[model samples]
Every structure is written in structure tokens, then in C-alpha cells.
Target chain A: MNVYLMIAVCSAVTLVPRILPLFVRTLDSLPKTIRKCMLLLPIAALGCLIFPLSLTDFSSSWYAGLVGVVAAFLSSYFRRPMIISIIISLVLTTLMLVLFP
Target chain B: MNVRRKSKAFQVLFAVAGECEFDENLIYSIAKHSHFWKNLHGKGIVLMQESTLCAKDGMKDGFPIFLGYFTTALAFGLLTRTSGLTLVQGVLISLTNYAGSGQFLMMNLYNAGSFLFEIALSVFFINSRYIFMSASLYPHLIDKKSVVKRILIGFGVTDENFAVSSLKGKMLPFPYMMGLIFTAYSGWVSGTFIGFVAGNFLPPVVQKASVITVYAMFASLLGGEVRRNAKALLVLLVSGLSNSVFILLVGIPTGFSFLLSMLLATAFACFIYTDEEVFGV
Candidate 1:
């Protein structure tokens, strides 16, 4: 694949979904079931992104990442803001890598 | 009780502020004694402050997300470089396609010499989630932004932006959204540039550790989401477990597997939560 053409193609594809909603009519009148199901998209999308994809680099420094996960969950569970949760997890991830290495 | 009236008061405050060209301290003093002040909650006050104090709040709000995106974007840039892409190409990818997973998958396909059609198909499916995100956010545009402005704003709606915007219950001002997007966009592009320029300087351990940021972010988001609702927890499990199955046993591509799992989990959630009997955990 020609690199520039591939990048353009990929970029266009991603933008299509995002830009489409601006042109389409509002979704307020959609079926109740569909709207309710749509609410789950963010959760499901987050879940889909989390598990197997996150499990990829585990064999090498899985413990470090795992430690980060625990810290992140605790931070969020305590109702901390997104930034605080991320900072806590990053710090924990770094600490785990150092301590375990 | 009346959310629309309160929101309208918010728009009027900002509009008058803009017309009069009020200073920050003046607006702050007025906001303290404003009638809407008594009726509105803490969120409304913050939205009022956003008209003048946006930069400060935006920076504060955008910083943590910036940190997360910066590290992952740096890793992405490094990946692009190693994949034989030029620094310019890597940066272009970040600028044009801010979707992190989609960009990663694109490079993977490129490296594998996958057919162009395959690349296009995977990219479309990977990013199809954005349609839902954008549609969900449309109702929150207070001013009924024009198509041109909507297109511009739509271009910047990544997962992180959607999360941030969705949580804010009011219509997002263009400037406020711009402030948020500005910080994130700069962090992402700069991080990518730095990664491309200094790929070899970072220790392998640090690079490896940075990969955890994505997982940590998602986990944290899920934690916040499920802390109150059992149904959300069920959806999370269904999506995560099903994704694992699809990837491990069924041998589906990561992008396709993720999209499929999302569909299955969302459909199941619709069924499970229909009656709202088990609404609360």
C-alpha cells in the first residue's frame, strides 16, 4: 500500500462516522430500545478496548500493568476525577516496574 | 426542577457577558449574586465560570487526559517509526486520525501488506463507534451549531473527548470544547513528534510500561461507570469476556472482535435492562 494513500483512506474512514451525525437528523425519535442500547456503547466500547488488547504485553511486564489496573480501579471507585485516577495509575505503574525489575 | 430554564439562564449570562465585554472579576461578582445562582447547582456555577475562567478550568480538566494521551501517542509515534514510516507520516496520522486504536490497526495492516479494501474495512468498523458517540452528543449542542462548526467539532470527538463531554450535563460551548481539544491535540501531536525524534533514547522498560496507560484509562472509566449500576457491570463483563473469547479461541482479528463484542454486549444490555426491575445494584 502506498503510505500516503493508505493514511488518507484510513483517516477518511474514521472521520466518516464522526462527521456523519452532523448531517443526519437528530436521534431523539429513535426506538426506545435502540436509544437504551446506545447507552451501553460507551461501556461496551471501553470493555472491548480493555481486556484482550490490554492483555497483549502481559507476558513481559504484566504485573506492572496489572498493578496499574488495580490502582486505577481504586481511584475511580473512590470517585476521583479522571486526571487524578490516571496520575495515580501512572505513578503506580512506574513504581511497580521499578520495584519488580 | 426545570433544567431548560436554568440552561437558558446560563446561555443568557454568557451572551450578555459577550455583548457587554465584561471583565472576569465583574462577571464573577455578578455570578455570585445572580438569581440563577440560587436555583442552579454546582455544575451550573462551573458552567458560568467557564465563560470567563475557561482557560484555567480547561487546563485543569485537560491536563490528566493530556498525560494519558501523550504517553500513548508517543508510543504510537515510535511504532510508526519502527514500521518504516517517516516522522512526517506518523505526525500526519496523529493529526488526521486521532483515533488511537484505528491508527495502530492501520499500521499493522500496512505492515502486513493487507489489501487496501481490507484496511478500509477494518478502519471503518474500528471507528464506527464514533457515530453513536456523536449522535449522543448532538442534543447537548446548546446553540444548534451550524453544519460547518459541527463538522469541525465532530472531527475532534475521540473517546476521551466524548467521555469528558458526556459527563458534563449542559450544552458545551464552542470555546470550552476548543479549549479541551486544544490541550489534548497539542499533547498528542507533540508527544508523537518527540517519540519519533527520540525513539531510541527511552529505555525499553519505560516504553513497555507506558503501554499500561491505555488499559489503566479504560479500567478507570469502567470503574466509574459500574460503581453504581449492576447492569453496567454486567455489560462490562459481557463485553470483556466475549472479546477475550473471540480473540483467543475464535481467532478473530482484534478490531473485528472488539466491534462484535460491543454489539453482543450492547444487545444483551438492552434485553437485561428493559424492565428496569434490577435497575439498582
Candidate 2:
């Protein structure tokens, strides 16, 4: 596929679901069971994302990912703000790369 | 004349007194009848109110959260460029191919000279989960709105936005969700552009290192969900085991391996946990 066309098409396709609610009038009226399932989708997707990472060969990237995971978990466990958790994880990951290198 | 003036002053005082009494009584009545005050006494109401407030706050707070997503897009762009994609191609990938996993997988497959069918299947499998995500979010959407708006908003429902919006425990207003989506969309596209442009300047090692950002963000998101639903613990275990076994034994394509693992995990969860009330349709 032409890269530009491919990107545009894929971006449009992805955006479709993301922006669906803008046209709808009532999001809360959907079936309860459906909403329940939707709640689990993120976790499922997240699993897919990290699964590949874990399998990759050991490298600075893997180590950085480990640090980030720990930092994110700790911050989240303590109920720190999302932004804080992300910042801490990123900073920790970056530092691990610098220090270990 | 003096009597008339005194009567007028008395009338003005009485009017002031009447207004004060009316205001006080109105306040008392509202305190007794308003849902806000009533909710203070009801556990369910209090929980609902709190969740509503949280959702509202989350919508407002979505901007900063999306910055991480932007970084992930940047990393993806960097990877894509190194994989032989042009700068424009990288930008298009970020904009059109908004799916983080699918795009990454496609890039990897492209490098391997995978067959068209293989690539298509991988994309379908990775994106299949969205069918479920969309189904779940469908009810929370404003179904009565214009089709154009619905389609537009639906496009932005990535894992990040979906998770944040779902936690709000209420259907977010369309405008608010738009704000969140647009902010994230901009971040992703811009990040990709920057990453592609900068990819040439960075060493191969540095470019490779950047890939970890996506993994880190994914870990955080996964960890958050796992903490909430112990069921996810089972899913993670099953997925990890299944992927490893498939890789070792079957030697299926990488994308297919992931798809099979996810399906196996979901099926296992469905069968093992028969309590429909807990697992849902």
C-alpha cells in the first residue's frame, strides 16, 4: 500500500471507534453486559502489548522496561496520580539506560 | 403625613423580613429533597456520585495522560523509519495506523517478507479485540447523535482513552471525549513526525532503546488493570504460557502466535469462570 494512503486509511479506521461517541446521543443507555466486556478490553490489549516485550532478548531496552514496570506499579499502588506514575516510570527508565550504559 | 411615612417604612421592613424567611425555607427544603444531600445518606448513591465526579475529573485530566501515548507514537515512528519507512510513511502510520500493536506487528512482518495473507490475518487478529471493546462502549455512547459524529469519535477509542473513559463509570459527554481524543491524536501524529525526523540523527542503539517506551507504558496500563481485576492475573498467566508454548512448538508466525494466545486465554477465562454474572457476555 502507498504509505500515505495506508496511514490515512489506517488512521481513519482506528479513529472510527475512538470517535464513535461524538455522534451518539447517549452512551449510558447501552446494555450493561456490553459495558462490562468493554471494561476488560484494555487489560487484554495491554497484555498483548507487553507480552512481546517480555519475550525480546535481554538488552538495555528490556531492563528499562523492567524499571518502568516496577516504578509504575509502585506509584499506582500508592494511589499516586497517573501523571506522576508515568513521569516516575519514564524518568526511572531513562536513568536506568544512562546508568547501565 | 407622619403616620403615612411610618406605614411606608413598616411595609418596607415587612417585605425584607418576608424575603429572608422565604430564602431560608427554600434552602431547608432543598437540603431535604436534593439528590446531593440525599446521596450523603445512601451508600449506593454516594458511590455513584463519587464515580460520576471521578469521570468528570478524568475527562478534564486526560490531556496529560495522553502525553505518554504521544511518546509511544514517537517510538513507533522511530522504529518504522529505521525499518525502511520514509518520513511521510511514518507520519501516515501514526495518523492512519493508530493501532500501536498492529502497526508494530506489520512493520516486523514487513521486514520478514511475510505473505499478504499472513499480514492481513495478523492485523485482523490483533485488532479483533476492538470488536469487544467497541461492543462494550456502544451503550455508553450517544446512539441518537448524527452518524458522522459517532463514526468520528469511535475512531479515537484506543486502549488509553478507553481505559481512562471507562474508569469514569459514566458515559462521558461527547465534547469532553473529543477533547481527550483530539489531544491524544495530535500527540501521536506529532510524536511520529518528530521521531522520524530525529531518527536519522540518533545511533542505532539509541533508536532501539526508544522502543522500550511503548513497553513501559503498556506495562503500566496492564499493571493497573491487573490490580483491579484478579481475573486478569489468570489471563496474563495463560497468555504468557500460551505464547511461549506456541513459539517453542508450533513455530507459527509471530502475529498469529499472539492471536492464538489471546483467543486461548479468553476462551479459558470464559469456560473456567462460568458465573455469567461475573464474566458477562
Candidate 3:
């Protein structure tokens, strides 16, 4: 497959959904239940984003990604500022890999 | 966490940024300069009316997201390089597709030597969730006169900007939204560039460790959501479980598994949680 053509194809497909909603103003007309479901999509999507993927993110280290997840889970539990928790996770995960490896 | 004042010219900051850094002197100076100072001097408190959140302000609002995206994209750049893409192609992906997960899926497919059609199909399904986000955001961009601005804003809408604006629960100006998106977009692109170019100087060990950085972001975000909303736990469980099952046992593609997990969780959440419980603003 042509790499540039593949990039174009992927970019084109990606734009369709992101840009399609701009032209359509259907939120107000939707049913209450449907609206609620639509609104809930982010959380559901977030859930899918984290699991299985996080575990598989590390190509070389098996538990490095898990360590990052755990660091994030523990540090963010107190409702800390967004960056603080992430930095903590990054530092800890990096340290784990560097030391253990 | 709301504070009400009975006196005139009383103002309260929501402290959504987790800092209640309201200085009386600063407020007075800003109020003295703003036109709303006169309208609000002897009237009741109105938060949005007093300050015009311009593009500059939006950039300020988006600073956190910018910082996060920079680090996350750095990791992405490193990962892409290791995944056998050149710096230019990695940058190309970041440039054209601002959506994170979709780009990751694209790289994965491309690396796996998947056909263009398959890559396009998977990316389409993975990114389709943005439809709901953009549709939900339609209510806020209700200004009819600025169709061009609306289109631009819609193109730039990411999860962070959308969350920040929606948390305000008001119609935001076009400049502010653009500012937020531009700041975040710059961070993402620049980070990728630096990570690919400068990241080449990073020790191989550090490069290997960087893959966990993006996951760290998602974990923290989900943690924050769980802290705020009670039912986020259930959403997390069902969606995560279903996605794991679909991908692991059923052997579906990651993109399709993601979509199914999202729908199942959304349906489950709607049936169980009330409107107020599900909607956090």
C-alpha cells in the first residue's frame, strides 16, 4: 500500500465523524434517554481507552505499563491537580523500568 | 462548593482549577478596567458577565491540557519511531489526525501491514465516538452567524477542550475555543517533533520507559472522573471488561472492541444511573 495514500485514507475517514456533527444540529431534537446516552459516551469511551491497552503499551517491559496505571490510580485518588498525578506516574514508571531492568 | 454573598458587587470563583486564588486587589483592578465593573458595581453576582473569556484567556485555560498533551505526544513520537515510522510520517499522523487513539490505531494497523481499506475502516470506527462529543457540543456553539467559526471549532474539539468548556455549562465565545484548541494542538505537534528529533538523544532505556506516559494520562483522567462521578466506576468496569473480552477472547479488532464497549457501557449507564448522576458539570 502507498504510505501517503494510506495516510490520506486514514485522515479522510477520521475527519468524517469529527466534522460531520458540526453541520448537523440534532441534539435538541433527540429524546431525553438518547441525549443522556450520548452524554455518557465519554465515560464509557474512557473506560475502553484505559484497560487492556495500558497493559499492552510497554513493548519491552511486561509490568511497566501496569506500574504506570497503578501509580496513576493511587496518586489521582485524592483529587489532586491533573499534572501532579501524571508526573508522579511518569517518574515512578520510569524509575521502575530503569531499576528493574 | 459554592459560596453566596448577600451584599452588592459580591463575586465568587468556582475554583474548578482546584485553586481558590481569588485576590481582592487583582479582582478590583480587573473590575475597574472591565466594562462590567460599572454594570456589576451595585448589582448581584454574575460570573461570566464580568469577564470576557477571550482567546488569550482560552489559551490560559488550555495550558494544563497543553502541558499534558506535550508529554503524552512526546511518548507518542517515541513509540511511533520504535514502531518503524520515520519522524516525518509520525509528525504527519499528529498533524492530520489530532485524535489520539485513532492515530495510535492507524500506526498499529500500518505496522501490522494492514491494507489501506482496513486501516481506514478501523480508524473510522475508532474516531466515530467524536460524533457524540461534537453533537453534544452543538448546543454550546448555538451562534448562527459564525458558521465558519463553528466549523473551525468543531474541527479542533478534543476531549480536554470539550470537557473544560462543558464544565462551564455556557455558550463560550469562538476566540476562546480556538485559543484552547490551538494551544493544545501546538503542544501535541511540537512535542511529537521534539520527541522524534531530540528524543533520539534520549537513552534507549528512557525511550523504552516513555511508552507508559500516555497510559498514565488516561489513568489519571479516569481517576479524576471516578472521583467526581459515582457511577463512573460502573462505566469503567463494564466498558473495560467488555473491551478486554472482545479483544482477547472474541479476537475482534481493537477499534471494533472499543466501539462495542462504549455502546454497551453507555446503554448500561443510561438504564441504571439517573440524569443528574450521569451528567457532571
Candidate 4:
């Protein structure tokens, strides 16, 4: 396959759903049950995204990630802004990398 | 002309007009004191609304979770160049864009001359879940007025956008979706370009090391979620068990293992908590 062509086709195909809502008229009404089901999508996606990270064997990288996750949860629970939680987690992870190395 | 009668009539007219004016002022005063007016005066109200809406859309749909994806894309670009792809090829892949899984699969499938059918099947299988995801989000779309609009927006549906858009429901306006997608798309493309550039300037080890940043960010987000909902404990347990079984007993590829784990976990959760109230339904 021509890599460029493949990339183009793939990108085009992938972007379809992402950009579709921009033009569609929002549904004026939906059944209450369907609306309720929509809420589970995020939790499912998040679970998939995060589950792999914890299992990755990046040496001390896993520990660093663990620390970052703990810190983020605590900060978020305390009502700290996400940006603050993110920065603190990153800084802490980087420090762990340096200290352990 | 009876002067006394005329004076009495003028006095009655004045009294009626005064009463009407007083009632109008009283109604206006009550309206001004209402909660609707008070909310409008608060400085942070608009900002708070926008932020909450953005958070719901961006965070839920993985698209706005750009920082990790950006770092990973950059790493992929650098890796691709080392693996024999040209700089143009690397940039095009990220720019034209698909999710990381499909792209990674494509990279693995790339050879001197690969068959079209093989590649197509791989892409289809990897992306099949998106069909369900888009369907789930169909009801929440703000622009479902026409077939053309549906087809167009349907094209952008990925795990990230679907996740984000579904959670947002009606709260996510079209402009916000545009903003979220634009940011994510740009981040992926630019990150790839930077990765390609960095590939030329930096050592291989340094380029590889940058990947840890993506992992760090993912950990932060996932960790937070797990802590918040005790139910997530079941997800974690089911996922871990299935993954171990698939990897150890079945000896499947990591990608397949991860996918299987997700399916099993979701299925188990659905069965075990059938009576549990689903939030967005």
C-alpha cells in the first residue's frame, strides 16, 4: 500500500464521526432510556484508555504513573483545578524518574 | 359648564392613572430581585458554564485529552522515520489521522508490498467498535437535521469524540465540538511534525524517553476516575483477570488481550449490575 494514500484514507474515515455533529441539528428530544445509556460511554472509554497504562512495563514508569494517579485523585477530590492536578502529577512523576534513576 | 362636576371627573381620572403606574413599578421591582437577574450579574456564571460544558465534552470524549495523544503521536512519528518511513509519510499519517491503535496496526502491517484486503480487514476489525459508539451518540448529536450532516459528522467519530460527545448530550453545542476536535487534530499533526524534527536532532534514547510523558498523563486521568467511583473497582478486577487469562493461558497478542478484557469487563458489569441504574440512559 502507498503509505500516504493509506494515511489519507484512514484519517478521512476516522474523522467522520468526530466532525459530524458540527453540522447536524441537535435532536430536540430523545427517549429517556437512551439518554441514560449515553452516560456509560465515557466510563467505558476511560476504563479502556487507562487500563492499558497501568499494565505497561515501563520499568519505574509504572510507579511514576501510580503516583501521578494518586495525586490527581486527591487533588480533584479536594476541588483543585484539573490544570493544577495535572502539573503536580507531571512534576511528581518527573521527580520520581530522576530520584529513582 | 358645571365647574364642580368637571373637577370631580379630573380627580377620578388622576387617581386611576396613579394606581396603574404604582402597580407597574411594583412588578418591575419584583422582577429585578428575582434569581434569574441575580445569576446574570454574577461574574463567573458564564465562565463556569462554559468550563463545565467543556470539561464534560472534552474529558468524556478522549479527543480533548490531547496532551497524552500528542506526546504519543510525536513518539510514533520519530519511530516511524527510524522504521523506514519518510518524514512526509509520518506527517501525513498523523495529520490525516486515525486513532493510535489503527495507526499502530497499519505500521505493523506496512511492508515492501502488502495486500489491500489484508490491510482493509485489519482496519475494519480494529475500528468496528466505532460503529456501536457512533450509534450510541446518534441521539445526542446537535446537527442531525439532514443525511449529509450525519454522514459528515459520522466520519469524525473515534473513540475519543464518541466518548466526549455522548457524555455531553445537549450541553455540547456544535461550536464546542469543533473547538475540541480542532485542538486535538492540530495537536496530533503538530506533535508528529515535532517528533519528526526531533528525530533528526535528538538521540534515539531521548526520543523513546519522551513516550513516558504520555503514560504519565494517562495514569493521572485514569487514577482519578478509579478513585472517584467504587464501581470502577469491579471494572479494574474484571479487566485485570481477563487480561491475565488471555495473555497467560491463551497467549494472545497484547492488543487482542486488551480488547478482550474490555469486552469481558463491560459484559460482566452489565450482568452483575443489571438492576443498577444506568446514568445516561
lDDT of 1 at B211: 60
lDDT tens digits by residue: candidate 1, B58-175: 5555665577677667667776776788999999999988887678667655654557777787677657657766766665554455777787778878766665554454456666
3 or 4, which is superior by TM-score?
3
Q: Name the best candidate (by TM-score).
A: 3
Chain A TM-score of each model, in the order shown? 0.72, 0.63, 0.71, 0.65
Candidate 3 structure quality by residue, lDDT tens digits, B1-281: 12212111122122223232112122222212222222343264534333366889779877766776776677678768877778888899888888776776676556545566667776776565566566656645535367787767877866556656544434577888888889888998988888788667878776666666666656766776666666778888998899889877898877666667877987887787775454322
- Which regions in candidate 2 have their CA more than 4 angstroms from the true location? A1-42, A45-54, A57-101, B1-62, B65-68, B99-145, B159-180, B200-203, B271-281
Please give the CA lDDT of all the candidate structures. 0.64, 0.54, 0.65, 0.49
A12-81 per-residue lDDT for model 3 (tens digits): 8877676677787553245657656654565566677777777666655668778888788666667555
Poorest stretch of ten by lDDT in candidate 3 chain B: B1-10
DockQ of 1: 0.46
Candidate 1: deviation at residue A30, Å?
3.4
- All candidates' TM-scores? 0.63, 0.59, 0.70, 0.51
Candidate 3 regions with alpha-carbon error over 4 angstroms? A1-14, A56-61, A98-101, B1-65, B100-148, B160-180
**lDDT tens digits by residue: candidate 2, B127-219:** 544544454455444432567666655776665555444434344566666776677678778888887887789765555455554555455
lDDT of model 2, residue B55: 30
Fnat of candidate 2 is 0.26
Deviation in Å, model 4, residue B245 alpha carbon? 4.7
lDDT rank order: 3, 1, 2, 4
